[model samples]
Target chain A: MDGTLGEAGEFGLIAELVKIFEGSVDGDEHVLVGPGDDAAVLRIKHGHVVVSTDLMVEGRHFRRDWASASDVGHRAAAQNLSDINAMGGTARHLTIGLAAPADLPVEWALDFARGFAEECKSVGATVVGGDITRADEIVIAVTVIGQCTQSPVLRSGAEAGDVLALVGRQGWAAGGLAVLGRGFRSPRALVEAYRRPEPPYAAGRQAAEAGATSLIDVSDGLLAEARHLAEASGVAIDVRRGAFEIPEPLTAVGAALGADPMQFILGGGDDHALLATFPDVASVPTGWQVVGEVLEGSGVTVDGLAYDGPTGWTHF
Target chain B: MDGTLGEAGEFGLIAELVKIFEGSVDGDEHVLVGPGDDAAVLRIKHGHVVVSTDLMVEGRHFRRDWASASDVGHRAAAQNLSDINAMGGTARHLTIGLAAPADLPVEWALDFARGFAEECKSVGATVVGGDITRADEIVIAVTVIGQCTQSPVLRSGAEAGDVLALVGRQGWAAGGLAVLGRGFRSPRALVEAYRRPEPPYAAGRQAAEAGATSLIDVSDGLLAEARHLAEASGVAIDVRRGAFEIPEPLTAVGAALGADPMQFILGGGDDHALLATFPDVASVPTGWQVVGEVLEGSGVTVDGLAYDGPTGWTHF
Candidate 1:
């Protein structure tokens, strides 16, 4: 049981992974048939289901030395779950497809599952089933199934005169990544942000209830996400620099690195914050901060001017 | 569009991939929102939903030199779609997670998507959405969403009195793989089998409609899958060798390679065949061959004796 996955074999490793989620699966009323079947059967009371998938390759997404197995797992879950949240739906189930080198330790996988299970449990979700295979590098692909309690929100629904609001931290993860890149871990908050993002899970539904016109998750920096909303909705967005109250940690890290903290807020991503356009400021839910406004045009701007900063995360 | 993925960039490549599935998505009645959104919104008319995920890794599960991009794509979709079939559900939606080196040609990705789309179209399913990332090697993870018209058929429902049956070709892919492994490609059919498996997609629903006691897809050879069914159902299965009328192609390949054709029939896999247990031989659906029976015991046997040959494919 303590040996490498190569020794455990695929079936043996799957048994261990299944054992880790046994309690979660058994307790979930929605799951009619869990792991060990050809597929999982789940009762979906909602008429519509929101689905999304995210793939994280070992070195591209996280370095083992920089992030623990548990951190990687939580990060993967957070991103996928955030996609469901972006749709104004509650995350209900997850199916993971994992590929790792045969020499990987069995315990690493189990610990990863523990982290993933804890995250899902926190949001009233569970891992119903998954597949494991051998690969040269570690790759994790998670697909989240969610149910919409109301009409699903879309990025193209924004209209002119809508107020742009944000829920959850922005640029904290980017700041964290910057700090880690500079070889300084003392600013633990930033480093932790880079390790695992904490997306506002409930804010999505709250925004829907509050009559949000358009919605998206800020996996890319605020500017890039604002651009997405603007392009999709056929409207222009204008962000006011003074509207943001920069977090102290980001300020300190920016001072230390001789970089403007505003750049981090404007251009950094991986925070998984909810960005939505409401009919007006009053329609923005409590705990949501208004950072911009929608106008009758296209593209994103900062203080009526185009932002020349780096545009969030890009894979290629 | 004619350049490498690195040249196209993430958004550009995604635009291309989304274009490939545009027609499929537009024609689907179940799709509420398609790609370019944070997540796809799908209407699930069935009371319960069936979900499954599969991962394919380069070199391990496939090789670019051996299989074309389209072949790999078809293989990925086929395996995941078959999982839904095994649950006695109709596959309705798919979410793909693809990771490949940045320098890979964008045309390959487009070709892959085209193959995936064609396969899904054959069964009236569509690619709802997907994610693309950069990795050291190509890794594909596909998750399928399906709808069941009736109660799901689980692998644990087999009884001692049930008759075991199989639909779809078994061991044909295995024979193809063997032929390809030996640096010989004379038998075009066997090589084609390895390139892409043709699963009996309708037989799962047929078996379910005819009242199957238990059901499973033979991704692992028949013997391995039989063991899984037996162990899950707490019943033993007895396979009759004489029941299988070995195909002429397999027989010819076996003769040329000096291997027993029965070995492929019994131990070969990747055929995506549906194996089910029925209350009696009379309940077996058309096109399904009754090859064995469930017995009051544990494990599986061939001709009333333990099968000593290779059990089947092992991932790790």
Candidate 2:
């Protein structure tokens, strides 16, 4: 009667999981050979396949008490999907590797799969394959496969004199994280934002069509990612602090906590906003806002000065 | 001067680790974009891309005390590569997801990376990209991308009257595991085999070239994999127990341990040998040994009798 891994056993639990994931496939035949096989065969739909993977661990990536198992699934999916989006590609298929304690409830796994599958489907992709096993703690890794609509964008494509821009959500997740870290849970919107920041899923393709040269997701704050773009492209980027204009929910939270909203805008990551550079600001599409400009130098400068703040997040 | 991850830091260690992985790429341009990017772009060259991922936890999948860090890397790569081999495809690129303790020595990671990269190169592939981070316990997941030369050989392809043969080494690794588990390490060959079983890397293509109807690697023991093939193909497999011919070191070790070598031959999984079905016995390839026959039924029987022994292995 115990609906845990110990009761279902490895193969039995996998059987149940296989049925759950099978229901979520796109049915568009992007996956030639689905799960329950030695390996999955993916049909290459576009010019090329864009693949990326990210791993989440308990205590390090997520606190189980702070978020539900479903939220953990969402967080894992968001990380990988955002990477594909950063590449200017449409996600097509995904394979997940999940290892959890034997005592983990089967119902929890089912919910996690649903949330994970929901995220993939939202991006117009399918959860083609995955592996679920037993471990000491929860270890979830999702590898996303995407199809490039045109030339896949790279981080090294930015040019000197290009107008650096921003698209989609920003800063709210970091504010939400700060609130949650300080043990406050009343602000449901901010709490939810930290759990799963809505990424601009289709904006990567939009930017690609708009002829944007360089692009990256704000997984590592604006300043840090700007530095990455600049360093990778071998050019400098100068940000006009006046452009960020700390948006809604975050502003209220910042005021309540007596924290600088500018610091959040400058250093808050996990918003998954598309930070890109275009040859001309006029061609940078509708959703994007110009924030900085590329130059023939190195590193990043905020308003012509090195804005000394914490750069971003790291694993170590 | 502390050699731990806390002292080395994530980016600083990644900077060192990048050089280790970068040296393993296939020089002939299969990798369009290497590590340090959000995602890796691999040039597709075949019918389709074959992908499989496996997650190994510290105590469940391996023992740190038994296998060195380099051996852990080798074991991880071999498991993934053999999966592609099982599908009759040539491996091209790999993206790794690793989460280790913060106090883990930087030297340990470097050695692990070298072994991982070496195994990748051995299979004519490259480590395209990877993510490394901190976790309570080390978790390693490798997703291997392969290009199929022809219609992939699937587990469902075996038909009645097909000759089930095995190519490459077998039974040794499982026997090795048992001996190692028993806390005796004198039998160096068996101990080494358990640590890093050299899979028949080239025989997968050879079997495909010889027109294999069905194929699978003996990762979950021969009988267990035989059952997998039979169940997937909707047929029965009658394994001939008389044929395995108990090889030298295994027989000696079996005698020493008061164990039957046949059990290891029948159910040992980690050998990574290719167990496959062919249309004609004569066409089972030069290196292959015929040990079973496919028939019109379900499940697997050893010499016309149901196998009462342990089927294979599972973490749970």
Candidate 3:
């Protein structure tokens, strides 16, 4: 049990991982056929099925030294589950495809499955099936299936004169990555944010129910997503710099690094905050901060002018 | 237009790949929302949803020099789609997550997507949504969403008095792999089988309708899958070696390499043949070759005795 994957073999490693996920499926009537088969079967009992996929590479998306297997698993589940939420759906099932080096510890794979199952359980979802393979570097691919109770929210539904709103944290992950870049992990909150982001999952459904015009997850910073929303909706978005009241953790991190916290808010990625546009300020849901406005033009601007800073990430 | 992924940027590469999938989604009404969104929405109009996932790495699952990008794509699609077919389901949608190095040619990625889409299109399925990331090596993960038209066939349903039947080729891929390993690739069919398996996709539904008691896709050779079905159902399978009429291609390859073609049929992997059991020999569907019988015992045997050879593949 304490040996590497090579020692345990593929089937042995999979048996260990399945034991972790099988515990999360108790009392779930929707699962017609669970793991240990060629495929998993589930009943979709709503309007439509919402599906999305994401990949997390070992060195590019995460680091073994910076994040544990559990942390990587949590982040992987969060990112894909947030996509379903972005579409105003409830996540029901997840299938993971993991490829790792043969020398990787069996404990790492088991802990990853535990973390993934725990995250799925938080939202009434289960890991139904997956494939494991050998590779030079670790790569985790997650596909999420969700059911929509209402019409899905789209990125192209925004209109001019709509109010722009934000929910959850945006700059924390950026700040944590910055801290990590400096080889300092003292700021526990910031470092944790970078390791495992907690997306505001319920906010997406709430936004859809509140008649939000457009919805998007703030994965690629606020300003970059605003630009995407603007282009997709064929309108412009203007952000007010005074809208953000920097959190204490970010402020402390900024002071320690002698860097402006606003840059992180405007350019950092992986926070998974919910960015939405509403018909008016009154239509914006409670706990959702009004940060900007939809306008007659193109592209995103700050206070009616362009704010010159980094916008987002490009994997290539 | 003809540059590496690094030159195209992530968005540019995604845009290029999206165009390939977009062509495959035309006139598919089940797709409420397709690619270019956070998630794709699909209408599931059947008994239940069947889902499966698979991962293919560059050096392990495939070789860039041995197989083209399109071949890899076809192989990835075939493996997952066959999983759905194994459950007597019709595939509806596919979501692919691809991670590759920045130096990878954009053409390679596009070709991969094209091949995947083409394979899916053959089964009336379309690519929905996916995430692309940068990694040190190429890793392709595919998840398929399918709908069951009837009750799904499970591996644990085979009875002791059932008759075993096999559909599709089992040893062609193994023969091709042996040829490739020895630096010989004259037999086009075998090499093609190794690069992209053609599973008898329609035979699964036919078997289910004909009252198949147990079903499995022979991904890891005939003996390996037979052993799996036997273990899952708590029954024993006895394969008659004389039942196999070794194909001419395999015979030629086996003769040239001074190896037994029977070994390929018994121990090869990646052919993706459909194996099922019926209550009696009379219930076996047309075109399915009866190869064995289920007995009241445990484990799989050849000629009622243990066959000493490679059973199947292990990733580790």
> What interface RMSD does every candidate have?
0.9, 1.3, 0.7
lDDT string for model 2 (B85-123, tens) is 998888888889888888888887888888888888887
**Candidate that would win on DockQ:** 3
lDDT (CA) for every model shown?
0.91, 0.85, 0.91
Off by over 4 Å in 3: none
Candidate 3 local lDDT, A175-209, one digit each (tens) = 99889889898589988998989999899999999
Q: Scoring each candidate complex against the real one, what DockQ results?
A: 0.88, 0.72, 0.90
Reference-based lDDT, residue A39, model 1: 91
Off by over 4 Å in 2: none
- Give the TM-score of each candidate: 0.98, 0.96, 0.99
As for model 3, its CA RMSD to the true structure in angstroms is 1.1
After superposition, which runs of candidate 1 have C-alpha atoms over 4 Å from their true positions?
none
lDDT string for model 3 (B95-140, tens) is 9999999999999999999999999999999999888999989999
What TM value does model 2 have? Answer: 0.96
What tens-digit string does per-residue lDDT give for candidate 1 at A121-192? 889999998999999899999999999979999999999999999999998999988887777885898889
